[model samples]
Target: MSETELPPEPALDAGELDADDRLKPEFVRSVLDAVEEGDTEAAKARVEPLHPADIADLIELTPADLRPALAAALSDRLDGDVLAEMNDWVREELLAALEPHQVADLAAELDTDDAVAIIETLEEEDQRAVLRALDPDDRAAIEEALSYPEESAGRLMQRELIAVPEHWTVGDVIDYLRSDEELSTDFWEIFVVDPAHRPVGTCHLSWLLRTPRVVQVTDVMRREQTLIPVDMDQEEVALRFQKYALISAAVIDAGGRLVGMITVDDVVHIISEEAGEDALLLSGAGDGDINEPVRDSYRSRVRWLVANLFTALVASFIIAQFGAAIEQMVALAVLMPIVASIGGNAGTQTMAIAVRALATNQLTQSNTLRTVRREIVVALLNGATIAVLLGIGAALVFANPQLGVVIAAAMVINVLVAGLAGVLVPVTLERLGQDPAVASSVFVTMVTDSMGFFAFLGLAVASGLVG
Candidate 1:
């Protein structure tokens, strides 16, 4: 089936496991029931209704304490596609729970990339045992993939791909495809390669099937194809796929010989990961997978909160500067928080947009100034709209029109500063070769909160509205 047409899997029912979500709770209960009964037939029946992805999600969602029972129930039915969909943490746990030979048996059913992903999570000793359990050829392929750097194209690309000699006629290609016992499953295109086994061009399966049998493979092939280097980072590989709108691209080695192929399907996973990773990094929440252990979750999130505490202290220090003003005029204390809160929210909004744009390459040095100007303009309009409403409210509440004017002016200043800081901080951080998403929020919040307090309270004191 086409990627878009792939059936929905619904047995996982993990976090956000509302009844209406794709993976319903009822299905999860059914799977557990079957596992408890030690009925592999019933377990497969329960899962047979779900998609491979959903089956994978179900495996991941099964409580760690209950996984061995579930795995034993599923038996050989726990296939490659299901393994591919499992979260890393859960996958590792499951692999450890199984014997090395059992893990190797299941992994061997997968494509080389999926197989590598599964085996890589095993303990080093377990990994060695699993590798030894596989057939020599399959073991060699997995070892070759493990040799590559983590998250590189070599580790992710499928080793199976169809390639043909440029000299072959359609008739020859047709007969070969029909008779060859060893063609890769689910290929989109047939690559045309030179004698050195380097791809020169590619022919879409649609074109291959429609052409006259007498036509040479080269006659119908498109020579201008995206060639992926095995060593390219997965992020760069995803960028190339997005930029070129590629469905599949051939992976070549140092000698420019076809080694494997990377598909849009794999790119989909990379895009999801990179996007989710940045979101988690921005919030100082590492990984953010629900299956992650509690200690790990706390360890990742607390450091960021500690950093936020230091930044919050800096904002508080600014507030201390206007202590006399706040003491003399209670209005200063009430109004100060309003300014900081508004500016903090505004800065967060702008920062989120900038970070996303940077990830998508929609915001870059070329349009950095333009983006900054646009956000500043946005802040000005937002400030004016909010200030008018707030100023009028403050005037009536405090029974002092002058106090309203002080706050309104401060509001405008703080918000405009927020917009500028929001864009500039992340952009500057990125330029300095740091991940803008990783620590940008803390810095932007510090600027907005400190400036908001200083502008509002300091102005009230300077305006003689307070002793």
Candidate 2:
């Protein structure tokens, strides 16, 4: 190479990652540059030192056109761990490019849950092919996992837990653990099961160490344990973990037999995903991931926009009815938007609180009335404060006390109606077996906008400010 054609930049060292442990922009660009230049060795070497998640990040950061090449360059290092860390959309793309046997190999290296996560997203025919390629044992495990509904405990649990018979002595448990090289090493607690394979108690490692070797495991194990049903929604699983401060819990089937286990680490990922999912769903944005496909993003978002369009027409229809009143006093038109906009914001704030409360199980049938009452009182206080301030300003600016009273009264009515709708819409949807977050915003926005326009204009005519 000529002197003017400078040597390629070297790989980033350990210090190059930012404080959040995210790979730096320059580092990512350098690796991508190496791949683009066809210097596969340089690209591989640059990524070799990074963690699996970081490697996943590097692939995600690579442009879509370059992803396959980058992935190919790092194929030796790309295994179950990196795949597990990848964004779901990106992983699906990479997995699609791989042969069924290749996917089986990756799935074999993962625990049951991670393996299921990787495999479940495959097409039905591809899923069957991958299953055929898997070992008999792995195939059975994955098949059972796939049988459960998506996002249930069965789909999220790993079958690699250590479960000891209830009759085993501490010494017996120790001997089996020592001798059984096939047993999983990642567990923090061991489940003690009865003859029927039903979990009776849980034994922490510390307890086993402190107890006498001759003592029965059941004697030392904690009898009070939270058992998660196989069909339990993952959100409820997260709530269980949070409420009980659980390190690990047994996942049981309909027969009350321990089928697998879920640890805190798995629940942590679920918690983040659920929280973000609910937030996005509330905004009518489906699966708001940056790596989401353009078509998918468009499809999910446009439907909501269409829904909003219909909702907006309802408000428009209200405004059209009062066109004469608005035209009679131009100030009415100028001030009307303030009522709607402020009411909308107020509704959003209350709806957020209600949704969060419901998500966390803090708002339930036992206390729904209390929550409603509390929000109503809060809305009144907010409405009154804003109304007083707005009233004075409208009075001074418009030089009409009656106009000020009209707008101020309309603001209170709209905001109060907004707050009421915010809570009621979500609760009502939830009761009707719909996801509150997914439909709440549209309904709440409709209520606020319609009431804002209707209240302001209707009150104006009654107050003799116009029309």
TM-score of each: 0.91, 0.96
At residue 112, candidate 1 shows an lDDT of 87
Candidate 1: where is the Cα deviation over 4 Å?
Answer: 1-23, 38-40
Scored by lDDT, the top model is 2
On residues 342-384, what C-alpha lDDT tens digit does candidate 1 reach at each position?
9999998998899988877888999999998899899999999
lDDT (0 to 1) per candidate: 0.86, 0.91
Clashing pairs in 1: none
Which portions of model 2 show Cα errors greater than 4 Å?
1-22
Error of 2 at 51 (Å): 0.9
True lDDT of residue 66, candidate 2: 77
lDDT computed for candidate 2:
0.91
lDDT of 1 at 45: 67
